[model samples]
Target: MSSDRQPIPPTRPTGHQIIAPGHTFATVSDKISSIVLTRRTPLYWFIPFLIASALLMVFLVAVTALLVRGVGLWGIKVPVMWAWAITNFVWWIGIGHAGTLISAILLLLRQSWRNSINRFAEAMTLFAVACAGMFPLLHLGRPWLFYWLFPYPNTMNVQPQFRSPLVWDVFAVSTYATVSALFWYVGLIPDLATLRDRARNRGARIIYGILAMGWRGAASHWQKYETASLLLAGLATPLVLSVHTVVSFDFTIAILPGWHSTIFPPYFVAGAIYSGFAMVLVLAIPLRAMYGLQDLITMRHLDNMAKVMLATGEIVAYSYIFEAFISWYSGDKYEMFAMWNRMTGPYAVTYWTLIFCNLVFPQILWVKKIRTNVVWLFIVSVDVLVGMWLERYVIIVVSLHRDFLPSSWGIFHPTIWDVATYVGTLGLFFFLFFLFIRGLPMISIFEVRTLLPQAEVAEVEQ
Candidate 1:
């Protein structure tokens, strides 16, 4: 008997569509711009913003205390001179990587999915770098003289010690922040123009119009905008690798046993991407749910992000194993002891937990169910973040606590001040993020509009 049903035509995979169907350019713009332009703000928005503000206050208090009492307020000790401050610094820097990777490298590759998420990811980078920049300054005993880190022609003629990795960080992080800010703002121009046109109040239009810098959507304007974006993306792509690699240099160039290995550059880069993606998810999941942006963000973005976490997590896992193997294989007693100490030392619980968080927990992502499940993905993202923090703690504190001389071995415990400073940075990050989402379109209005079918049609016509 002949089947009544004709063979079903092979269908394209809908699993990774960047934007949901049935949306047009008008809807995309209205939905996104309205979030910023709405007369009445949502109750949910205020709750997190208030919490972040409170935390930002705590950060200010913590910084004030540090500046007043000096670095003595922190838990930094003799051998563990680098404690929470350095750990937080490195962690925040690493966290900034995903934004650059998603915004720049992926943009270069012409990955259309990035259009939905790149705006806030770039914001996250700027915010995280801001938080990271604060640590090194505070870590300097005389934070008042922070300008000394910069090279300038001055009366005193004090030059930053060029040999110090600390000096390199100043240049690296500053350049990263500058380029990232430009890239973020350039991307915002078109969106700002949209907001300017869409705003009802004259004041709102004036503000956005000023930021838009008189964007009229002319053909020449589009041509110039595309060129600037490409140039910035090209500049920023290397920063994704360079920033973290330079960060790794802070450890590798040192004679410290755990930090001396050549594997650190790639290892840190992989770990940065791993944690950065986790953070992106951590932010994306709640925001999407809160704003009812499911159609715009879609599970496809979440799934792709999770897959990235998995691939980077594998690399991180390999780095951990290689780190230990090299320590043992080097035949240096210091290296062997460092590895042994990490496994069986006072901070052994932290090490094992890091392993579970960075390696074991993320493995579940290989299963598609976990990758697609928002709640599970969020939890795993959090786990990876914590694991990455613990990894830094293990690398810095654990390694330093037990040095070559037994007499130098001393435990590092974070004082309340240390905890406050760290928690305060967390506050600062969220606070900036809260303000960003409220004031600007968290999703790019113009970029997301480009993902619509109409854009493709318009492009073909052009």
Candidate 2:
């Protein structure tokens, strides 16, 4: 008997069939343009411009002081050479990781929620990297001859040692910054086109139009854009992972008891993500409120990000425990002493503060109530960032203060220039972010449109 079944034919598009209308995409484009271009009042432009200008001036003054006076102005001295500057460098670099992880990794994973925050997150990565890069240059006593770090044949007889972690860090950070900027700019083209069309003035229209490269929302262009984005995401994922690992190598490869450890790479990666997610939350909450993007950046986005923070926080906590266990297991007196010193030594306050902020506070996010509340999340995020900074401080200061030579051991302190430079970097990071928000679309309009329920259903039906 013939089976009562029909063969399923391949679904094919008909040339005459009407293409689905993209109202949701158009609406998101309008909303994004409104945020970037339309200021309700002069304060929209004035506040950011004023704040950024002030911060930039401070940064310039601080740098000039650093250049004129020299590294002697900072607190760095014998035995405790690495101080706030290096700590800030590592912290900022770690902060940069979150943006790439959110934008590139989550994009490749097809996590739709990433659309709400990826643009600003990517911007944060670029700015953070820029800030991070400044420290190493300034940390060098002779800032003018900093090119010695690079391998130039014939010009300098000494080539950069491939085995050195600092050398690896230079390559890794430069590559990450370059690739992240390219990925961010490539992703911005469509949104820039949206801005081009929405511009009210000739100057605005001309600038945005040029940046948009005459993009007309053509299907072919979208196809190529999507492909390029995926390839970049693929490249960035490994780059993100490797960059942090290389950074860890700077400490781990050293013979210092606390610094040399196999577990550092993962631990550092987790801490980076933990702090990075906290930063994203800190920035996102204020931005969503300020830009009237509550609907676009929904509670769902916060909840999802909270989960990421919680997961990474747990990893960091475990890393702390693992470091303890490894110290004990290795039966190395110096390692054990270093671990003990971190807990009950002179800088125990910093160490415990790290434990409380990075590990303890983040546990509160496990509760749905706390995670969903934007205010609480923002508070926790700040706490986490503080804790992360302290963690770095503990790692650098505590370990180095009482190293192999008991006679040479001493406490490290930040001088006026150190304080100014640290504070100035924050100003610079914010200055860049503020300018980015005012001048460019901070959210991905095209990606957000794809997240609308109606759009999802439409795609499913198709």
Candidate 3:
């Protein structure tokens, strides 16, 4: 009875309380601006950037080698044609989706929590897509003729054949990258203006002013800004669904047993969000600690993102299970054998790793405490991100290394070149992100300030 004494009142969080209390417009502005302006650069930032730049150099070296030697330097061969390059392309593209999902989709749904995170997420989208777009272009036999994929009228009257799924991907990815860049830039305008007005030095003021594009922050400007963002979100929501659907078509349109599934479009979309959100958490954990913005990005934000990962991860697991079931249920010998191969073939280690990392490990998140715990959540995010990469590898390589004919069967082993290229892209992504954190406001300062209660209308006028 004593232990069961009267319960305390349950409190609810209001819209204004989405941000921490006592954070005024000036406070939010100062907190975010100080990182880029007043505070000296952190050593951790320099160390990582230096390492990333070194890897970027390696990437340049590897690309030069590939161009000079042709695509023969990599381990890609007859049966294992789609190897590490395509896998990296898909993984990067999938990782890019979380940014749009957070910036556009969640905005459409009116989630206030996203206000603090969408800026960097949108930036991540643009950078990830840039990296993803590189693979297909570099894999071209004549890297110099990469522009042939575009729909421009040639002097010789040549044009890109829109009938190809590869062509569809060209449109899908380019469009996605362009919209992501514009969306990201538009979001930055107000914040850039804040930086512009607050700059103590003429150099800082001029740099930020150009980026701000003469934003006056008038009421009419706010109205137009809201309208444009809403319309862009509408345009982007379907691109998220269609881009990956086109990616899945690259496999599904094939005659191969493992590749010709009808369920691939939705499955790919779900997998994209799953991996994308994992990358978000992976970045969020480190950034939150490094920036000392724990109050701004609390456990509540982490908990909510963990829930999205859990939901999407389950969809991915279901897709995997359904693929196997359909293969068995159809009684197609090649499909059944392909499913068996995934479970027990030479690449069984990879297959089971995908299952354990994507399916099994995420199950721990069903416990609230573990999902919210910093260490556990970070580990889970890392596991899922790696698992998604393995999932892409298994899907592409395993499917190709053993197709319909036993005579054509072979193995795929990534060469030093493959590893170097992937590592190089990693460095490039971090390099761009480092520059972003150093120069621009990583968090949306104005949006965060909106989450705190504003002064009364009369008080503002006075």
Each candidate: what lDDT?
A: 0.90, 0.85, 0.88
Across 1-462, the per-residue lDDT of candidate 3 in tens digits comes to 134844311111236555667787788899999888888899988998899899889989989999999888888998987788889999999999999999889888878788888888888888899889888888885779988889887798988878889999988999999989999999999999999998888999999999999998998888778879888999999998899999999999888878899989999999999989888888888998999988788778889999999999999999999999999999999999998999999999999999999999999999999988989998999999899999889889999989888998998888999999888899888888888999999999877876666632323454
**What's the candidate order when arranged by decreasing TM-score?**
1, 3, 2
Number of clashes recorded per candidate: 0, 0, 0
RMSD of 2: 5.7
lDDT of 1 by residue, 112-154 (tens): 7888899999999999999999998899899888888899999
Off by over 4 Å in 1: 1-16, 458-462
- 364: Cα error in model 3, Å: 0.7
Residue 17, candidate 3: alpha-carbon lDDT: 51
- How would the candidate models be sorted by lDDT, starting from the highest? 1, 3, 2
For residue 227, give model 1's deviation from the true position in Å. Answer: 1.5
- What TM-scores do the predictions have? 0.95, 0.92, 0.95
- Model 2 whole-model lDDT (C-alpha atoms): 0.85
Question: Lowest summed lDDT over 10 consecutive residues: which window, candidate 1?
Answer: 7-16
Q: Flag regions of model 3 displaced more than 4 Å.
A: 1-14, 455-462
